[model samples]
Target: MIISTRRIKQWLTFLILFVLFTLLLYQVMSFFTDMFEPDSIYKEPIGDAVKVFSDYGRQTSQATFSELVRERLLWFYEIGE
Candidate 1:
């Protein structure tokens, strides 16, 4: 099998752009999460997602997405109560 140089270059460019885009998106989401209070539905989910990501990095045990969502929701309800 033979691949063209131009095709390889295009694939590399696409990979780089995809990585940069993902990083930018994560930063933007994190910024909004930090900026907003967990008072409304929109803001709360963002904050929770940030917290979950942070926790995943910090802890020895890995948390599943469902577990993180459940824990965050429980916390939110407890705060409301």
Candidate 2:
């Protein structure tokens, strides 16, 4: 089969369109699904940011970060026995 340059260009265009269409469909589905569940359980950015800084500080100082962090979390959640 002798494939012409025009046919090759058309095939390339179709491949590009198919890929773009698939990406757009995926984005639309994700947007709708996220809107339905707007509130996420693990969405505490402020608290998480503070925790990351605290962990970094403890690691640099060679201190028992886990013990202190556990105590702090326990106090925050009132999970004392």
Candidate 3:
């Protein structure tokens, strides 16, 4: 059996391009899927922290930056426990 060099090169090129295309497609799909889906970690604790800060700020007339940070850290620690 005789295989032409040109034919071998063509097959190699096709295989490489196919693999690259598949990887690119996978990355694009993953990016879109993740973009559409909301992450719970941020949605839950972060959102709750924002609300707590807002309410606390209103009640105390103003919450210091350090106080807000402390509150958020405490909230996270309590959640972990």
The residue pairs found clashing in candidate 1 are none
Report lDDT (CA) for all predictions: 0.80, 0.78, 0.80
The RMSD (Cα, Å) of candidate 2 is 9.5
lDDT of 3 by residue, 1-81 (tens): 999999999999999999999999999999999999866756456333544335454565477867887888898899973
Give the clashing residue pairs of candidate 3, or none: none
Q: Quote each prediction's TM-score.
A: 0.45, 0.45, 0.49
Cα lDDT for residue 15, candidate 1 = 100
- Give per-residue lDDT, candidate 2, residue 62: 52
Best by TM-score: 3
lDDT for each residue of candidate 1 in 1-81, tens digit (9 for 90 to 100):
998999999999999999999999999999998888556655445333544346455666678767877998898899973
RMSD of 3: 7.4
User: Judged by lDDT relative to the true structure, which candidate is superior, 1 or 2?
Assistant: 1
- Candidate 2: C-alpha lDDT: 0.78
Q: Give the range where candidate 3 is weakest over 10 consecutive residues by summed lDDT.
A: 46-55
- Model 2 off-target regions past 4 Å? 38-81
